[model samples]
Target: MPHLTIVANITAKADKVELVKNELLKLVQPSLKDAGCINYVLHQDNVNPTLFMFYENWQTRELWQEHMNTSHVKALNEATEGAIEHVSLQEMTGIE
Candidate 1:
């Protein structure tokens, strides 16, 4: 089976960029340790400091969903409430 790829784009509220960034950073270590996680990398836009992106690869869609339900992810949601301007997510499978 092909791996599941996730591309998540996040835009932070103008005043809350650093807060959102710190909260997002807290997810990295735990996500990397999650079952079936092939890789989880975070990126920040060069031209827009308030924009952030996560490029993730998982063994399966189910495992990626599991990662989304993890405690750390939950905490991230709670911590960033109202601090985000917009979020977009794309789930894809690499074409081999």
Candidate 2:
């Protein structure tokens, strides 16, 4: 069973949402191929063009921590540096 769940809330620059989404897609597709990652998804709110949510499921907290330290993930963080106004995260544990 997956041990850690990650959720990230993102907001992008006004006209750069599409571009941000594209970058996120590129970041996540490769991330999902990692053994530690179970899934990675980005959700855009219908009412807010600049708002997005990232949900990632990891095989273990250790692996998730490792993922947080990876270059691609770090690049993704830097990629959105000035493009985002707010960034928050929530992590949950599955009972199963």
Q: lDDT of all the models against the reference?
A: 0.97, 0.84
Query: Could you tell me every candidate's TM-score relative to the true structure?
Result: 0.98, 0.86
Cα-based lDDT at residue 33, candidate 1 = 99
Find the candidate with the highest lDDT and give its number. 1
Off by over 4 Å in 1: none
Itemize residue pairs with steric clashes in candidate 2. Answer: none
Give the Cα error of residue 82 in candidate 2, in Å: 0.8
lDDT of 2 by residue, 6-96 (tens): 9988888888788778778778877887778988998999999889999999989898888788888888877777777777899998786
**C-alpha lDDT (0 to 100) for residue 38 of candidate 2:** 87
In candidate 1, what are the lDDT values of residues 10-76, reduced to their tens digit? Answer: 9999999999999999999999999999999999999999999999999999999999999999999
Q: What is the lDDT of residue 65 in candidate 1?
A: 95
